[model samples]
Target: MQAKSRALHEFGATFLGPALHVYAEAIESSGADHLPVCLAREGWCFHRLLKRLQRDHAIDLPRDPVYLRVSRTLLFRAMLGSETITRMALGNDFSGSVLDLMRKRFGLQLHEIFSALPIELLRFNCELPKDKDTVFEWLSPHLKALTTVVSPTRRALTAYLERSGLTDPHVRPLMLDLGYSGTIQKILTHTLKRDTSGLYFIATKPGETAVGDHQALLKGVFHEGVGWRSGCTMLDRSLLFECLLTAPHGQMVDMRQKSNGEFEYFYGREAATQRHFQDLKTVFDGAIDHVIMCRRHGVTYTRGDVQDLYEVFATKPNCIPHDVWHLFNVDDDIAGNGMINPMQMFAI
Candidate 1:
């Protein structure tokens, strides 16, 4: 267990090194005027690291990064206010029952969705087609009912954003997140009706396309291209990075404003008491220690270094104990995907 924890910590530091470098470069290129905002809960580490680095004079930023309490589920639900929903908003692919869609996408309970959805649709609560287009076609007829049920949530999200100063007229937010696609950034650009900039650890083809579509300025720190190309092997096991760089909290499921003008947050269930929770925490601590050490010694790591480390862990299953693999789990409750082991997300 000690060896496994140390390996994870070292890997975490190496992973963050290049990401931090790229973030600095992004700040330079995009101008220092934009307010840096880290998207939760993946961006939680980056936000913390940035503040730490700034204190040590390892990196400098015009303003502190804001840790925004938003999620893909909340953003997707907010898009329901629009008359037309894009493929991105609907998700690239979907696989679940209608009930799952209601609960996951709109945060509707069974009782709440039962009253809104037609009887015909309710009967097919087994599973929906995996193809997003097919799912969208099936949902086309009932969008009105779905939107009506979810509109209040959208209003709440808008209010939350406003309360957080994300919608401030004078400030432009540069979103930071560990990335595959820039879905959150794209949605924010649309919702705010303003062009936004995003700095990601990586941006897949869909993300690059969103740059043009939404007029977003997005840069992938490590590899920004279509799929896992020759040099971008890390994208193959991206979920591992997410597992390491998570916040010690449950995912934000819903938010509402009270009559007193205060906001209330609702979170999804989390496995904080899971057996592997302490191990996960230790790995995070290792990463933070690495950052401090690097700053103190003026040491820097290259992207090549990050990739090589990735290869070591990716190729050698023995590097991590067999028991530790199954113990680690990540939640994708936003999509109703449930808990998943990061190692199991890709074939190693």
Candidate 2:
């Protein structure tokens, strides 16, 4: 992440020469609606995390340490949902703000906050090749393929289905399970929680007007796929990225879940109230290294650029499996989360 952030900063500074700084976001919107965890101490660890990533990646960083701290703080403020929540949780009297006017005085780098925590990213392996250009193409070619594909099945269910009792396809328990998974995800995931919706307008940039329409900047990019290519085509996903930038709005959907469960879709958003997809996208483009506590250890997570990274994180980045399962409205909970399916404890 540190290496990637530096390259982007150099590119932006040398080429575009726009501000020589990037306004980054932290735990971006989870593309879809789902209650996100609001951790008060998240920012507290961000600074240290940045250093850890730098050391791990062996990247040369600036001398002034405080900038790193501030950068992470801003990233946390932007991505974690709402500033109001962060303000309230961290305390009513918060400082360390790096907004436009304040930015000149405290120009923080984007790398600081991103490398804060370590999460163990489960090994996706051959299951899904990381392709930023066409995540949708690589993962799910057809939405229905999300269900009909092979899944981790309960051994007994398979044996039972093979027996004569399951002569009728519609009546079969496996069929019912598959049907329930899709039906429930579509219905419940769509219902909105005023707080977690992906597309929203927080506040117009004080004086910084939109480049094109001069409208309140808002939108997100979300993707859902298990493998490299599945239901949606890669071209479609890439086009979606372009669309979000040019078009008025849309949230990036990176939520990845399956009919059964091995992997999952992460439902996420800032802890702040009333933030929009655009804000999330901006913040996401900032960070350096996000920790995965477990698997995928010591491996560099090379995706797209800051913009591309935002798209990946927007839908499904290093997310907790349980979190994703609930967020995207999938029904693979072994403990019977009833939101999608009644507890199948008896069968298990």
Candidate 3:
């Protein structure tokens, strides 16, 4: 039945122009409400990961679910209690939009010279903390004002959960992201106070000390393998694909309070950020179109099919047109990360 429906849709696209997008639209919409409210990490890579999760993992998500953009700042601040928030604020030299907001809105610039700044919130709060009392003492005075933003953000998020039906005990929404380690999921679960499950495109298991019980439930689709596996290595070596699958947005830097007593979300932005977003979206759409074209002729995508596709990309990247390649080659964090390089992973 599914195949027949898909065939008809493909037939529509062949003769018709953009009018046939309804079939693609239907495919995109099918399991959106049925599946968990997938919260993808806000980055350029997760878009490809989202495709895999939909096609391979059998998870139905809306076409570019906006709720998935729970940025690192939003998650960390929401999950951290007043104490931890205070500690991090005191222990670090705040910068960027967050710094500006804290200074202008709250008149706060609490810092310590010798103490290590809390560079990564998860690591600082969960893994390392040298002096708790000192952090508390330094930032105690400003805790109330800081929470003005964090608290409202949490309330807004809570409302979002309620609106999305994720808060329902019966619904188990999967958190999707590109993971080196599963810190974001941990903090997200802690913040939501829910037993979350996640699908990471590629990830290593967190150490025993990692936050939240969701770690055990974390599954990787294109995970780092235990031994040398040709398919896995080929997929990993496909740097263009890895770079192509990313969030077009910057990290959510701060939550701002309005005069009317509401909260607004703030994400780190650059002059070229919107342009970068548009380019990545173009690549993502092209990838999905390719998948749709293959399926049009009954060429169903299996796990092996995906592996073959990755190998093709890795070995013969020039197969992609110069225009598309230009879009995929944008300078992004995932490109600089060591994962972009090809590696020999075949076992001798």
Leading candidate by lDDT: 1
User: Lowest lDDT 10-mer window, candidate 3?
Assistant: 334-343
Worst 10 residues of 2 by lDDT: 172-181
lDDT tens per residue, model 3, 1-348: 355334433322321212112223333444443233344333333344345545653434544432455654465555334563334433333323333323322232334111222323212321114444544554455555446545666676666556556666665555555454455566655556666665554556533323343332465554543223444643345344434444555445445456675557665433232345665554445444544554454444444444554555456634444333333332322111222222222111
Query: For model 3, which pairs clash?
Result: 43-246, 43-247, 44-245, 44-246, 44-247, 45-245, 45-246, 45-247
Question: Worst ten-residue run, lDDT, model 1?
Answer: 205-214
What is the C-alpha lDDT profile of model 1 across 59-80, one tens digit per residue? 6677777888888776776565
Per-candidate clashes, comma-separated: 0, 52, 8
Q: What is candidate 2's CA lDDT for residue 110?
A: 32
> Candidates 2 and 3: which is better by TM-score?
3
**What would the per-residue lDDT of candidate 2 be over residues 1-348, giving only the tens digit for each residue?**
455444433332321111101211211212222221111122222333334444564333322112111111222222222222222222211223222111211121234222321112111211112221232232223223222221221122233223323223232111000010121111111111111111211111111212222222122222222222343222223321121221111111122234563222222222221133333232223323324211124433221243444334334533212211111221211111212211121111
Hey, what RMSD does candidate 1 come out at? 3.6
Leading candidate by TM-score: 1
Against the true structure, what is each candidate's TM-score?
Answer: 0.83, 0.18, 0.54
Give candidate 2's TM-score: 0.18
